[model samples]
Target: MDTIKKLLAAGKFDVVLNQLQERMLSDESEERKDALYYSAVALRYLGRLEEAHQRLDALLDCWSDFGRGHQELGHTMYALGREETALQAYYQALKLNPALYASWDATARIEAKLGNLQQAELNAEQAQFLQKQPKQVVGALNLFHEGKLFKAERICRAYLQRNPHHVEAMRTLALIGAKLDVLNDAEFLLESVLVLAPDYNRARYDYIKVLQRRQKFPQALAQAKLLRSDEPYNPLYKALHANLCSALDNHDEALSLYDELLSDKVGDVAGVYVAKGHLLKTLGDTKGAVACYQQAYQLQPLFGDAFWSLANLKTYRFDESEYQRMQAAVSANETRVEDKIHLNFALGKALEQQEAYDESFSYYRRGNVLKRETSQYKSEVLSQRVDAQVEYFDRDTVARWTHTSAQHRHLTPIFIVGLPRSGSTLVEQILAAHSQVDSTLELPNIPAIAHELNGRQVDRKKPLYPYILDELSAQQVEQLAQRYVDETRVYRSEAPFFTDKMPNNFRHIGLIKRLFPEAKIIDARRDPMDCCWSAYKQLFAEGQEFSYGFDTLADYYRDYLRMMKHWNQVFPGQIYTVFHERLVNDPELQITNLLNHLELEVEQQCFSPHQSDRSVKTASSEQVRQPINTKGIGQWRKFEAHLAPLKKALGDVLSEWAY
Candidate 1:
């Protein structure tokens, strides 16, 4: 590869091509990707534009996110006198990687020729900024965009070691940290970058993102507001601010901002439409949301989020035309992996609605496979984590922890914990319908607290979290409880009791009992086949990575049961279990039992939770908006033939949890 590069630089294009072709014939390994890419470059330099285009097409077919491949395609298109096509290719290249200065330069030239002065100037400025960056920083940025995060982090850290306090390097490292899911480090690095370069709008934008990922909504919103205040007309800043506002429940302001962006007719119009559609969906305006989602897909035919949004409505059905377009989008090579994932899931739902069970299952499996390839989840890691928790939080430990004096006894947080798609959201809606109960989102406080206790460790074999509870003084435990109440206050109203329906909180019941012994814990239980299959079909925005594969999903369900049973043994009669099938079969009797367990008087409205008009954010948002029914009970039966692995893995849990 180095020799080929040297040959190309020496203007020996023919020699470069010969070397790459010889290497490709002998090497059918990953290096072939490099060979194909370099061959395209050689062909373009030799003025064999057609061959260059074909080579780039083949390269991108296998590696669609290769930004340099797209940039070379742009060059080939320009050499073939297809200026508009070249411009589009350049835009695609930069979209994959903004670090591609050559693409930015080409785009700027083309836009200038087309008399788009503002866009041209912006492109030129971006190219100039990238050009001015240190070579290490530039290379790190490229690696980061190319998904080589570890390499990027190493380069960034080595550079930062020599040039300490360099804000750009710090920001670059922070971006890599965020990608690696070390969000606390990312947040701290971004904060440091802003302190050094307070006027750096880019760093500020990054800071807001890290804060948002950390679930510090108020802090993220404050930073977003500052960014918007600095450039009130900047559409990106305005859109981000609006998103934060929506997260913080400032719905009116979020809607107004979306309207402003729409009326201005600038900056991600289709995306704005989708955002508005989501807000409208949450607000229960099904008609308005449908219109906005339709408008989005019409504006951008391959926009997969719009299609998925329509499908996620649960009640929406795709027409023939819409269905055909989705199929075409999935087949298109230009469609990105992220978009393809969405399209596959959307198509699966569409086919399922049409009762094409076999085809629907195929699409669902394809989507999950694609998603699993990109995920960092390891079943062994999760299994080991659960094992650690079970081993550490034994009955004796629980007895000692529960004896710790409680601080926020007044804050009776109703924790709805279970697997996703296990009717946890439905339970929250029911509880929220009670006049004395307030419903919050899947609160991250518990997981966030556990994460903090985990600290930064080199070996995963030795974790500090559950064990740390043993050392915590009563005052420290009380302080942690106070922090939970204070941080979550923004998500609550005046209701004496508020529900924290974070499904994954089942893993941390030990910590919860230590902090607030009186807190209510509800185990939302569902039939194994129904729960596992439901989770398998859904594409969660984040987390729940185990749901992407049948084996993993089954293993996770078993682990959940093990942990829950252990919790029950430790705190007998403390955790309440709500069977979803029973609730659907006998709504009145089940709801009465649920309320009675919570020590609350049953209200007539609890029977009709679907009419509450509160915003429901889960995938069941649409399902929970209607009366309870048995529609979802045996959904896995449709694809039972394909679920052999799930059944084999689930084993006895099926019979144990089956209704």
Candidate 2:
């Protein structure tokens, strides 16, 4: 055994194997058992998994009291992807020594691979609890991988306290702080890691991420530059750099980088295609975006982000066949949690589009549940970690500004706000169809920016949003607002007016109105059940909280309505209401009214979105590809039978929509 260890430590794997062969006739039971286990592990690591399995079986048939040996065997089995055997090995190890954290961690990995996240988390917790010290970092990392953030934080912090210079511990702490929304803490921890180890490119890259999450754009850019200085050719750095540039509205530079990345030699760069698709979509080249999606799909079909994005570009109205295709795509593909949530929602939407209400509800329900959990992870986890008392804007500010702007006190820009699926895309498509108007699809990303501005919302009752309008000087507001307009200039170069249709802008109307007094705000409404349920069914890429399931979706719908009602009451005629059904039914009347409100000329194509050829990167893609049909007019009726729970929950609140 001692000789084998020396060979293994000296990197003499072949020598170790030869020694094992010689030990086939060892006189003692311990020597024989040792020889069998070592050979099995060596064989497994050497990729001779079948032989390793046979050897392991022979050993287990004889002596099996070695807990650590069983754990090592399980690790080898897991490496071979024989997960059931790995679980059995872990079970045997635990049967011998229940306190073994390695055995628990192995079990956790198997459970996670099977997608039993709850059980995986529980086992990870058990493993972590068994070894709650700095030496237990490995087990703690397993807990973190399983998304047990709180436990991971405790383990990491323990190490950080004793060994402040530990790079891995600091990196893990930074990540945990980021997830918990403690941006400052995360930033400090990561920066300290770099101070101790300036050559740590991975930590530098992750620092950029922390800055990005905090919406510290300039800092993020600076850190990104520093990172590039160290590793100029790293695709990961370039990708991150491209993302920051895009966020900063430096699209020209972003596009150039993205174009260069189109031929990226990196085998794992999926976002190059996604980035290319975004650039094309923004350029009004839907066909180009389609090609990019196809490329992305080819690279990773199980990548649900690609599938959902592709479905968003579909010309089919999510008809039954198209829905089946999306299902096949999702089923055939593997994905991250966010992508899975999106795919499920898209599948539900396709079912809804086909008038399969019950089936649609099932898909919507599943997607909504995932979305809620995701949101909880965000607001409860990420947001909680950031600096407290950071503020963001909401609709009340828009109302105040609209009222003032009407009085010529300010010139507010026009806002197109609603739930994502609630005619926001249609509104933009219709408005962009006009001669004087340009539409920038769901953008300006208010949530991330808001979180950054406020530092943290220490007291939710006194949110930073309400105070921003009363503070920021004219110059600051104008600069911030104008910078936004100039950045989006690519989308509206020729038009006199542009629409920002980011749905969550409903939360920041006050800031928008104050920034651009001339801004006309459009609050598009469909039936509550329709809008909420519709959103639940469709899969959005990012920054949507209500698209996952029924109860959570319903609550989110209520919050949206309540906020909108406050704005309407605060500044009545300033916010125009466009019923989605009415707009589809009387396109001309609604177009004329909507444009007249924006002080733009109504174009003939405004009513014919199908002719625009602009990419529809929302779930409404298929509907917009056809002439305004009454298919969606009675859409809520078919779902009414299946949405009894939703309807009962909504009560007469949906009566205003005249269900």
Candidate 3:
């Protein structure tokens, strides 16, 4: 220690670090562990988190069973922002030696980072039980993790009461307080964390998250500004600030920052470029948007959303040969089923258009198999959850619907519904292009309403009509309906009729009919397998567990089918099924029929949905932004060998759909 300190005092930190590295490579002595740990401390002081992760990883791999080695690696991984892996490492460390109480703190941090409250609490207790020495922050983390905010606050308060400077403990208490809806307590504790840490990354992120939740935008912005200044090298800090700016509608600033960021790119951040591309796309800069999206895809080869955006843009339309490259890019080592499915679907459409039906169908089948496994079972579960919720509301709101029908008026909203990725977004863009229709993004209110009525474990088969109808007083129905209207009204500027193109709204078809009978429900359908496969091949921003794995997604899709069938049976002829295949082959004819149903007199240019200067924000945005093309008809071919599970799970659904 003195040797390094003397070297550091002599302004030779670099030399000190270098000697430690040499010792790491040459020394088989136990002295190497000490050398490595000190070297890591120096690297962290230098703010070289990546290098630190590498050094720590090297030490841990060499001394695999060592508790301190694992703890050091976990800390480094956390600093490097690999939260999930950090938690696992910490857990491994504690298992190797339960007396390593420091692992608890790291595990707590990782659990919170991943938003796993249950696990966080468990780790917090582990910290308490294993504490060889109790400090001012004793038990606060565990209390907060357990959602016992009051007790957490007391612990933190007591810490501050004695030490009056326990910054980290105060911050931990404040974070929980804010989430627990005790804003005043959060304000007090966070102020303390900030004052003590001054530049703590954890405290800063927690503060911003809390402020954003409170909708204190200006304060959040200020904190964001401070964070970027304090943590200039942290890309995540910059991204969060950019996101906040976007949310506040400071597009010019956001765009400028994004533009600057693009000028000096980083690794594996396809999401940022995609965001920038979507923004450019919104501003009618299709060429620039496509360029940005291509950059994103180039950076992260297996990023499904990037490919979806690129495919959505007129990339392949301008250059069909990109299909092979896109396919190759998608088939990389880290290929996700969702990306592959979408790629294959896009490829199939491209090939089929080029008279490659056999190959196209091959892609289609591979994707279908993947789609079947991931979405099927989950879909059924969701339907049951919604049904149970509806049953609760039905028991209460039944009489209101009957009494309210006579007094209702002006129900002209168009719901663009169907399976996700079934061209709902495209269809809505076309309809929204009409002079009378406002094309809003997906509406999650229907599901939100359903969830609030009843939690998960819903019963779909039981008739909720009588009970639910009785439950909703006309006032309540009107209030709930009006809530949807109010939330959506912001997105509608001057269009006479607005479209809420939530594809999953198909599940709530009955509710839609009851609430707004006059509203048009356009059901967008692609080839059954194709639609399922496309969805399966994605890793969405939201919690879509089934989509990531094969078996779960197929089951989810089948449930969607089952629920839609039940919806059809109970409310016959309610939703207008717009086949994606039909639209792709004969867009003009289909659009005209769809318009006629919406009671809009056909304008000659509805066929040119691509020409409309509107931005499509969904996964289909890149593709739909361009002119309608037939390149995604059957995209399941390249990996057909691996799709047996999907076929087995979804054979009946595929057979019924004539695939």
Candidate 4:
């Protein structure tokens, strides 16, 4: 490393570049990125612009968030006299890392040349901000924004080692950690930063984001409240405060906050309308939601999310003009990739409602392709996790884990678990409609526990979770159980039992069973093709990555069946499986059977689950608000010709669950 550094320092670019190129082949992501970055820099200096561009492009292809690579690519493009393309690359680099002074200066120059003086002025000011920070800190900020989390982490840690108590460095590292989904690290770092510099509003705002990402809603709310108190008129803080309130189910308060923000004349009023529309939709206020969505559309027609929100209502019908606008927005070159995706899905739904199945399927397929290109989901990880659960939780292992005398005997929790878009939400609504049960939004406490059990070990090869289950003490198991009940209390009511309808809880049934041995666990099942088809078409708010691809969805469904079957075997009669089709066909009989499984009296309310006016927060929210019916039962048949890949992937499940 010293030799190559000295060679570069002495202007021996070719010798050092060759050495760095060989080192770039190492297995370590961080090391390879470092070598590749240095090599690209050397290539530019050696006037090998083409080679530098190729190397930088390859680096960014692997690590799309690498802001330095984008900046270098911009430089190479500029040197090659492709100034227009270079301007875009610079903008991309700055989007991830705002502190890229060189990129900013280059962008400003290009924009000035293009006669975009206003944008050039803005770029010049951003460059001045970067000039105030240390060069190393600016580099770290750029890497952090570019999405090179590992590289950013390294730079921040190294800088912190030298500066020891730099708050900005700590905050930057925390932001990177949050981006990397290491919420615990981000939380601790942000907490430390606040202790050092309590007046740092930006860090405090980031702290709120980290808390929210960790599902610490109460903590996030408190942080947001603090920010709002500090800057009572700040629209961003006000909006965040309203969002946190909504998350906590304080809908009335959230609505008031939104109203207050909407009245702010200087604010981006259209965004609040969209936010209010979502909140209204969640509260089952369809008319008000539609009005708010329309208001947003009127304010900003190009905002695809507004139209998507209307279509996501599953009941919204688009007029011809709305349809044409969506089509134009989708075809427009200036429309963002993200907006185009939403527009495509909305258009697909609109066409599907009109019975244009072929065109609808094409739109849906296009949207998925666009989304899949950016998705980082890998099915093998999910497959391996399932395999580990099956291997680790045999009958003997289950019995051993539950052999301890201490147990939380409370049956106040009813978990409705299944694939997203299965009948889980419908089941939850039915149970919640019962006089003895209350409904909570899909609580993250259960999965949060599993995440906690998967400790913070840095090694990637070691299994940290189910394997560690064998080592848990009886007291620890009891505490984990009690902790879930305690933490989830915020989402409960005075009703004896509350339903947590987290569909993904199907993944962690073993931990759940060991914790609350008597808790009612309903395995909501639907016809495989219908369920997978619904999931494929739905654009979930978050955390259903498996449904984005047909192959992944099929493999996930098969593994889910395997896990549920294993659980049923180990704990016979413990899980109640409800077929969605059967439930839809014979509501009374199915409701009676479901109520009997829970040891509750059969109620007419359960038969009319959709009439309860409860806030359903799933893709089936709208459907579940209507009477039990078979409208969605075999809807997959309409797209049968386009479902060959799905049918092939589903294999046995499709055949077995055929109508």
Candidate 5:
């Protein structure tokens, strides 16, 4: 590969092609993907435009997100005197990777020749920006876009070692950290970059994104306000501010910003429409949301997000033409993997609505397979973590760390913990309907704290969190508990209690007990088959990586049950279990029992939680807005034939959960 790169750099295009061809004869490994891309580049530079185009088409057919492959195709198109095709290729390249300087340069030149002066100038500016970056930074950016995140991090860190104050290098490293799920390091690095380069709009923008990812909505909104103030008319900044507002539950402000962006005819028009649609959906305006989603797909027929949004409503049925469009989009060679995944899921839902069970399962399986290929989830790693938790947080260990002081006993956070798609959101809605209770989004604070306590070497054989909890002093415990309260205050109103319906919080039940001994914990349970099957079909925005594969999903459910059972035995009667089946079957009785468990007086509004106007930000948002029903109970039965692996993996869990 190094020799071929050297040959290409030396303009020995023929030699480069020869070497790649020889390597391709026997090397059918993953590196062949790179070989194909390099061969396309070599062919284009050698002025073999037709061959280059053919190679690029074949390469892209297998690797749709290959940004450099698209860039080389752009060059080939230009050499063939096809300016429009070349421009489209460049656009696609930049869509996959904005850091491609050559693509940006080519786009600028084409736009200028076509007399799109404004767009040409914007493209020129982007090209110039990339051209001005340090070579190492540019290389790191390319590697990052290629998904070689560790390599990119190494480059950025090596660059920063000598030039410690280089904001670009720091920002690039921070971007890698965010991608690697090291949000704490990413947030800190971005903060430092902003402190050193206060006027760096790009750094500030990145800082806001990191903050948003950390679930620091108010802080992110504050940064977004500063960014928007710096460029008040910038459509991207305005849209970002709107998103932050939506995150903070300022839906009216978010909708207004979306309207402004749309009316101005700038800044990702289709995306803005989708954002508006999401806001409408959260606000319980199904008709308006559906219309907005329809408008988005109408504007960009290949936009899979719009199609998925409609399907995710769980009740929306696709018309014949819409369904055909999704099929065509999924089948299109130009469709990227990310878009293909969304289209597959949408098609699955559409087929299911039409009662084409086999076809529906095929699409769902295809989407999950594609998604799982990209995920780094290991079921054993999660099982190991659960084992550590169970081992470390035994009865004696729990008793040792139990908060005895009344200093923090009043901090009664109602944690609804379970697996995703297990009706946790419904429990939250029911509790949030109570006058004394506030509801927040799936909070990330507990997980963030756990990550911090796990120390820097998180992947070590033994983690530091649950063990470290035993070593903390009373003051340290109080401070940590208070930090949770203070940090989460942004997400609450004047209610006496707030609900943190983070399903994964079940893993940290011991920590929760140590922090707030009097806190209410609810174990949201569902039929094992239903829960696993529901999770397998859904494409979570993030953090539910195990759901992308049936075996992983089943293993995760089993781990959850194991961990919950341990917590139950350690702190008997401290956790209330809410079976989703019981809740749906007898809402009033379940609601009464739930409130009684929390020692709260039942309100009439609790029985009619679907009427609450509070925003819901889960995939279950649409479902929870309607009356409770058994529609989702036996959904797995439709695809039972295709669920052998899931059923086998679930094993005794099916019988235990009475599925």
Candidate 6:
């Protein structure tokens, strides 16, 4: 850093550029980032703004989270007389590193020149405030924006130890925790910052995100309302408010807000169209949803999400021209990794619809490979989690640690859980067909509770959750149970029963039993190959990381089976298994047995669940909208020749499940 400053001061820009070029090529260390950054600075000083912009773009291609690169790019663009482009880059830089004083100053000047005095003053004030922060705090912010999260956390923690009241440091650390998926710790840190500085708008926005991730929808909605009131004209806050309303089942209001935002023709118009499409799809307005998704891609040709959403409908077909357009977009030089993933999946679906199986599989494999390259999932960690549950939740252990506390029986929650694409959604739709039941999307409350319990520490030791279940007091269990009920109330009506159909909740059965022993648990079972292959072929919006690879997905299915077997042994008859084949083969017998299990009278709606107007949000949404059929019963047979890896991974479990 001192050498770079001295070189700049000495007016040796060419020498600095040469040295940085060599370092960038030869050194793969952390210093490579500095080399890349300083090379751009040298290029800018040498009156080669285009070269500087190109180098910064390359830097960002390698590290998209590098805020400094964006800031430098902004400076280069400004020097090249592109004020609007520079402003966009500056906004992005501030989004990544709000403490970038120079970017703030630049933005203030640019906005003032554009005659936006209010925003200019706000940026100027931000610059002044950030200038007062310690250098260490600024360095930590830079590191955090560079995606060196662990190093940034260490620096932030060290700085906060000396200046604990630094709200920005707290916010940065909380954001790091969020990126690491330790949302509880992030929520705690942000909450503390807000308490100390109640008017901290940035911290409040982040707090809302943590709350949303934790499935505290009411709290998130409250925060969104506050932000909307503060800046009623801000499209970002209005979009968030609309999304929160949709999450809380206020579909009509969310649609209205989205329409209002769209009418203004504001930021990310294609994104607003996609959001409206999703809400319309959930409301069973298929034609309207299709039109919206089509409009989204038409407006932004590179927007792969719009294409993927259309394919995910499972009923949409692509013409040859549409396929060619997506292929071109996928191969485009400027297409981002995220967009490519979506395009590949969408193209795979399009090809599969045309019966081009090999080409379809290739696209699917490519998509999954790209997705896995960035995923943090490890099959071994999931294996250990399964093993922990088996070791900790045996019949004898449950009998000894069982909290004899009163289970919250005021509202019965029918839990439909199993592997992804294992007919859980279909089962939920059938059950929800009853007049006494309300269907909800995959509620995240149970998994959030499990995450909290698994992340709790004692004496700084590793978390012991299923094991910790043995030590919970009656009051604690009741409180946890009630919290689930209260958190889920937003998705409920006056119906006697509501379904929580989160397929991954199969892993948290023991926790469910501990909290709500009387709650009805339905294990929605399907043919292993069909279920695994189906999930492998689909791209989920989030979570279900195991589905991205074939062998890992099959092994995950095996683990799911092993865990389910253990749960059945530990608490026999508590869970009722519903086989997809049997249900489809004999609807009358299956529906009767299902109704008997729930202790409800059989309704005709259960037999014709497709006629119900309930919202379905799973990948099987389109499939469930039609009457039950055997079309998907043996889907694995179509890809049997290529499924040897999956079959081998499953081993004896395949024969045991009689697949």
Which predicted model would earn the best TM-score? 5
User: Which rank order by lDDT, best down to worst?
Assistant: 1, 5, 6, 4, 2, 3
Q: Is candidate 2 or candidate 5 better by lDDT?
A: 5
Model 6 scores a C-alpha lDDT of 0.85
Off by over 4 Å in 4: 1-129, 402-411, 457-462
lDDT of each: 0.89, 0.68, 0.67, 0.83, 0.89, 0.85
Off by over 4 Å in 1: 22-29, 402-407
Please tell me which model should have the higher lDDT, number 3 or number 4. Answer: 4
Superposed model 2: Cα runs more than 4 Å off:
1-144, 151-174, 177-199, 207-235, 238-265, 269-301, 314-361, 377-412, 433-438, 444-496, 514-518, 601-630
Each prediction's total of clashing residue pairs, residues at least 3 apart in sequence or on different chains, is 0, 39, 62, 2, 0, 0
**Model 4, 1-659: lDDT tens per residue?**
66766887888998878788767999987778878887888898899888888888668756655666788889999999999999978887776667778999999899999998987997888778678777777788876665557787888899999997888889888888777666778899999999999988889999998887766788899989889889998888999899899888899999999999888744668889998999898889999999999898788766778889999999889999999989988875445566777888899999999999999999998888877866778877777777777887878877666545543464468889989888888888888889989788888888877866877652345558788887888788888888887777777777888888888898788888888777889999988989999988887777787887899999999989988888888788989999999898998888899999899988887888878876766767788888888898789999999999999998998666643
Ranked candidates, highest TM-score first: 5, 1, 6, 4, 2, 3
| Cα lDDT tens digits for candidate 1, 1-659 | 78888898999988888777776655564578889999988888888888888888888876777888888889899989999999988988998898999999999999999999999999999999999999999999999998889899999999999999988899999999888777878889999999899999999999999888767899999999899889999999999999888888789999999999999989998999999899889888899999999999999888999999999999999999999999999988777788889999999999999999999999999999989988878777777778888889877776555444454566799999999999998899999999999899998889988887988551378788788887888788889999999888889988889999989999999888888888999999999999999999999978899999988998899899999988998889999999999999999999999999999999999999899889987889999999988999999999988899999999999777654
Model 3 per-residue lDDT at 60: 61
Q: What TM-score do all the candidates reach, one by one?
A: 0.97, 0.64, 0.59, 0.83, 0.97, 0.90
- 497-609 per-residue lDDT for model 3 (tens digits): 78887767766776776667677777777776667667665434444555644556667677666666666555566567788888888888888988887789898767888
Error of 1 at 95 (Å): 1.7
* True lDDT of residue 642, candidate 3: 54
Off by over 4 Å in 5: 22-29, 402-409
RMSD of 5: 1.6
Q: Which ten residues in a row have the lowest lDDT in candidate 1?
A: 399-408
255-304 per-residue lDDT for model 2 (tens digits): 77777676765624566887777666655566877777667766765456
Q: Which residue runs does candidate 6 get wrong by more than 4 Å?
A: 1-38, 48-67, 81-104, 107-132, 401-407, 456-462, 636-642
